[model samples]
Target: MNSTRRDFTELTMMSKEKWNDEELFYFQHALSQLLQYVNPEGLSILHEINREMHSRD
Candidate 1:
């Protein structure tokens, strides 16, 4: 993975245990908003985050 994805994944893992349902929901919503304005690389990161979050459900 690129540095962006690697850094994001690391951050997510570090915070994973601390996220409550509401926080996760808010994060997803924020990512969705960001997606609208980001480039393809950013979109990929958002998608990865979404997939990771969903897999936790």
Candidate 2:
């Protein structure tokens, strides 16, 4: 597999562990940035769109 795909799988597995509060925060932050890059702005836009959709209901 490509390095990005491999790294993402590893991140998914690693994040499932019971990390300390600080470690979990850092891991989530890194994962979010990685996903943002992978989606080329889609992630942020989707989040904003989802917020608006939910607010409208």
Candidate 3:
């Protein structure tokens, strides 16, 4: 999967354990919308986090 998708998958997995189904759904939906306008710096940060998460896997 792409890094972004992978990172999101990892996040969803973690959130599933911590949040109720409805809460998790809204959290992911909000994040998905927020990501659409992320600045270059923010995108880089997310890429870095994705890399870190991938390395752990």
Candidate 4:
């Protein structure tokens, strides 16, 4: 897991625009399950995944 904002940003940027449909669907489902218990960082990751998913629309 990324310990700092910079690393998290780097990871997010690296992963953005890279998820295929199946991967995005998997992440969306997994993150939705984590939504109830996720920390703020997890929320951010989930948000990014959702953003990518929506971008496909």
Best by TM-score: 4
Best by lDDT: 4
Whichever of 1 and 2 has more TM-score, that candidate is: 1
lDDT of each: 0.61, 0.45, 0.50, 0.70
lDDT of 4 by residue, 1-57 (tens): 323233334545667576566666766697798688888988888888889888889
| Per-residue lDDT over 1-57 for candidate 3, one digit per residue giving the tens place of the 0 to 100 score | 223233444553453344334444444455457798877855654555444444545
Question: Candidates ranked by lDDT, best first?
Answer: 4, 1, 3, 2
| Model 2 Cα shift for residue 22 (angstroms) | 0.7
Q: For residues 1-57, what per-residue lDDT tens digits would candidate 1 score against the true structure?
A: 223233344556655445555555655687788767877866765676576678787
Q: What residue pairs clash in candidate 3, if any at all?
A: none
Q: Write the per-residue lDDT of candidate 2 for residues 1-57, one digit (tens) a residue.
A: 223233334544543333333443444566467674657454654354344444545
What is the Cα-based TM-score of model 3? Answer: 0.42
Residue 10 of model 1: what lDDT? 52
Return the clash pairs for model 2, or none: none
**Could you tell me which 10 consecutive residues in candidate 3 have the lowest summed lDDT?**
1-10
TM-score of model 4 (CA atoms): 0.67
lDDT of 3 at 24: 41
What is residue 48's positional error in candidate 2, in angstroms? Answer: 21
Clashes of each: 0, 0, 0, 0
Q: Candidate 1 or 2, higher lDDT?
A: 1
